[model samples]
Target: MDRPVSKVREAKLELYRKKGNIHAKEVTGRFNTLRWGMVWLTQTIFYGLCWINWESAGSVRQAVLFDIAHEKLYLFGLVLWPQDALLLALVLIIAATALFLVTALAGRLFCGFACPQTVYTSIFTWIEARIEGDHLARLRLDAGPMSLRKLLIKTAKHSLWAIVAIWTAVTFVGYFTPIRELLPTVVALKTGPWEAFWLIFYAAFTYVQAGLAREAVCQHMCPYSRFQGVMFDPATSNVAYDRQRGEPRSNRRQAGQTGDCIDCGICVQVCPTGIDIRDGLQYQCINCGLCIDACDQVMEKIGAPLGLIRFASETALVAPEKHRPWYTRPRIGAYAALLLIFCGMGVWTLEHRSLLLVDVLRDRGALLRETAEGEIENAYTLKLMNLSEVPRDFIVRVAGMPGARIVGEERFTAEPGSIRPVSVTVAAPSDSSLSGIQPMLFSIQAADDRSIEVVEKSSFILP
Candidate 1:
């Protein structure tokens, strides 16, 4: 019974929704203005961040790059090795927590204002509007027979879209491959197969997802929309219609008494997702506030109060809900606490991170060899990682067994942020009683700074 009822409702929705074409009518209001502002800010950051270069030890590279080839992530002065994956995990958790907190207070704020799909869709639509004229004009053009003028107009519009999509792809890939280096490789047609593939794939993805998919992505593809309900409470604010204030809807020509709404369909016409705000909240709604802007214009023209459509909570609209401080809310407090804890841990870990790291790899070729002085010698390769921004001299020493000492060069110089491998041979007086592997320790200390040090355990051979 439930399935049948839902299918019937879906059929009704399909009838009401526009077929193929959805050119949202242009609107102007505070929300529209804010949306445009966010579009500019986000696009600027995305396109320009890869070009920022930082210099270290007379070499320059992208400030924020994840050099997968080199197994290092650079964010300005901080370089994270693969072992620092914990910090990256913390960052993801913090971002998710922050999103939850925002959702609990103002629903889908990020999705509407800052999501990549929404941003790119707005950009593409703006371009379409510019090239093809207003929403009405585009509709007319689409409906009319194809002509040379229509062909030329469409060609120009698509060319512009292609340019934007390709460039967006380039900028996105630039974070992994330095933009300066990648541009040359691209121009020379020397990009590797993988890079070329990503370039084409990403370009097509952006073009189709932003220009063609549009609201369909939000309505269907976005898993977040389905799960966002869990993040919402009755007190959660979202773009909604004040049905109590303006309902019993009527046209101007009708009646002795009427509500503020003039039955103007402008809100529906201007909605990107084509869902009427007055129909109540739906998962399809992006909460972009364009409907609010359109309804506000209608109210303004009719000399009615603004905000017939606004960011409002269900509880408040049903019955005036009493507001409380954010700290007083248990859910909000929990979200904040989680965010703070992760952030604190990240900061503390970064601050106290050691400048030197070491690993001891025993040579398997010859575990134990007899020395000329009646001693047993063990060969090893020391992997010393210099995580600091300056060069430092490191001294390696061996301990544990009696008369154990380094047989080869004990001091080595390591450059800033370089991993140096040193061949080390430890020799100790041979003991007839001791056999097989014996416990030993390798100490690596910076010649200038004792604080920068590491002690690693290894096994010494006895014969």
Candidate 2:
């Protein structure tokens, strides 16, 4: 039996539909300038931060290194340990909230302007344009027969892309492993297995995502575009086509027979995701405003007023007079309020965070031991973390039982930015009236600055 003709045709079309690649036309205007400005700003911060030097705890190192080996994070003057993970959690919360607020205020602003994918793709495409001429030239070259010149150009483009990708990977991994140390190892071709693995992995990912995947990553792979509707409202500003003025689009400029769009298709030509804006907003649109830039240029050339396509809200396009200010909208205001609250909480928590942390573990081997002097003994291990920048001596003390006291060394010096585990014996008079499990408090205080303190509670076994 044979399959139906419709089914076979549909299958063939589906297979061939995605055969070609998109070569977005080069556009220059206000939005293009703004996009490049963000690319410069973000890349400067990312690639330059690793090379910045700072002195911490008498050692010079990268200004913002997350020393995973030591389980510590160094950010300029602040040193954070695993125990300070709450601050990191708060930071993440503030970031997520900020993203939500921005999305409510302006749709896909991050994706269009500052997303790593967008930024890197812009860079990759810019390089491609510089080497391969404009979009039409590149498309012709791709469609034409293979030649030595075409092969050389293609190889050169990819070689440059690989260089940029590897550099990006190196900078990314530098945050986890000190760039200074990693650089020498890289030069020597002896990077650690994990470091090399991440560097190659990230490099390959950058190359593929920016060079090969391009718009597919934004349209199909990214979850942000799929659910952006949830964050959008009537007042959320987005790159939109003004249908009232652009409808009845025609190329010929006969008297009263034309719309502002001119039917040129430049907007579709320049779109990174290849969506026609005049058809209305679609999930494939990144809100990049390249179409706006392209349309503005075309309108300027034809002596027509600009803004045939622009950033507008659904309310503004449907009923301009009924549209309200963005910040005035209740949903936007609510998002802003929540964002501010999360930021405030993060700042407040960081401001009041403690410099010392302590954990006490009671020995499970023996509940209680009889001492030679007729005293009840209990063993414990103390894990102390010093989060400050300077070394300090910490004094340990035990309390709660009538005659409870620490028998071992009471004072110990801890190195700056280090965790120390100490074993201590707590002795109480065996003849004391206390029996069963007795509640006890273990306190550690800075010898020099007594105001710095940490207290932990544990049970003292009694026999």
Candidate 3:
């Protein structure tokens, strides 16, 4: 005879081992339709934007290009220099705030619908289903012995996956390079070393990640799933298995004796991450709600109430408590406020952006020199960067002194998207009693657009 505690521990160990693995069947529902819609919308925008070219002032480039090599970002009519990296930082913060707001309000809508991993995996699985058949047939095919049909099916599935992976890779690299040029080079097998390497690398990554790894990426690879717990509270609604009404579970058809759940395991079958929802909220759960769809279908077949598995808060299901609406949630409200503030700042920055930038550096080696005309002169270097798409002729002026003026010319022309560094001399009348190192402003105004002006302050030294 075995000791009672030892037998109980052994039984628990066996149960834990069994519980660790779950094979979820694919499911279709309203949420699934919405998810696929997002997939199409996002992928379409990503691919379409790559091919768009915008022509400005005789220079043509991709409408939205992040030219890392040139340290310049081009967005349609806007050009962002390296100094404007703060805008990128603000954009990231805004995105993070948006994610937080959505998570607090609805749950992991990002993970479920819009995440690349989920979307790509959904596509890969759809292709697999087309080639391999339904869930039962797929399982059977995998279990069956080696055959010509199996090999053909596998070959066809993998070939389609490879094509999609390659296309995805090309579109990704298109953000940095001109897509029209890159495509021809790729087709002719004349792509440069780095481009070819990245194309192959990204394609292989997509193929392996989406087709082979699948849910493992969501469960073990992604850090989002791990940190998602930090965003959750008792009121956070998640896809849950209502254990109160679901358990003392059995497969029998007894009336009113057991709870509604038939122990059909449809919820477990439809889960992509292979985690049983009935076991309680686990870290592996993406809150996709596929289990709800599967459970609802089962409930309908057995003439029971729907929503055996549904989106509900732990507080709502377990304890009798009134949960506040989304807008009332303190964390969500705070995130929303921050998002609005940053968005306003970004808009203001764009609105007040100048078309030209000027930097005036005084020649420290030799300051003030007496000219042959009996006037005190200062030598300075002016770096004028044209930020606009069109060619600009700027009328440069010097201010802060009564008789101060530029030596030779007042206007200079700058080509579109180019920087011009010109040496300039400023002269002051000898009789004028100007002090040593007096403050002066160098202002540049565009001839075409009077609203676009940039000013830099420098010291005017006298001998």
Tens digits of per-residue lDDT for model 2 on 1-463? 1235535544533333344778888889999999999999999999999889898668787889998988889888788888788889888888887888888877898999999999999999999999998988887788889999999999999999999999999999999998988888988989999999999999999999999899899989999898889999888889999888876776655556667766767787788887778889888888889999999999899888899899999999999899999767899888888878888888898887788888898887988999889888999989888888889899999887778899979998887888899898999987556789989999899998887998898888888
Backbone clash pairs for candidate 1 read: none
Per-model TM against the reference: 0.88, 0.89, 0.92
**In model 2, which runs have C-alpha deviations exceeding 4 angstroms?**
1-19, 254-257, 363-379, 399-405, 426-438, 459-463
Q: What is the lDDT of candidate 3?
A: 0.82
Minimal lDDT window, size 10, model 2: 9-18
Segments in model 3 whose C-alpha atoms lie over 4 Å from true places? 1-24, 58-60, 253-255, 431-433
In TM-score terms, which candidate is top? 3
TM-score quality measure for candidate 1: 0.88
The C-alpha lDDT values of all candidates are 0.87, 0.86, 0.82
Q: On lDDT, who's better, 2 or 3?
A: 2
lDDT of model number 2 = 0.86
Predictions: Cα RMSD each: 5.1, 6.0, 4.2
RMSD of 3: 4.2
Scored against the true structure, residue 334 in model 2 reaches a CA lDDT of 85
Error of 1 at 412 (Å): 1.9
Better of 1 and 3 by lDDT: 1
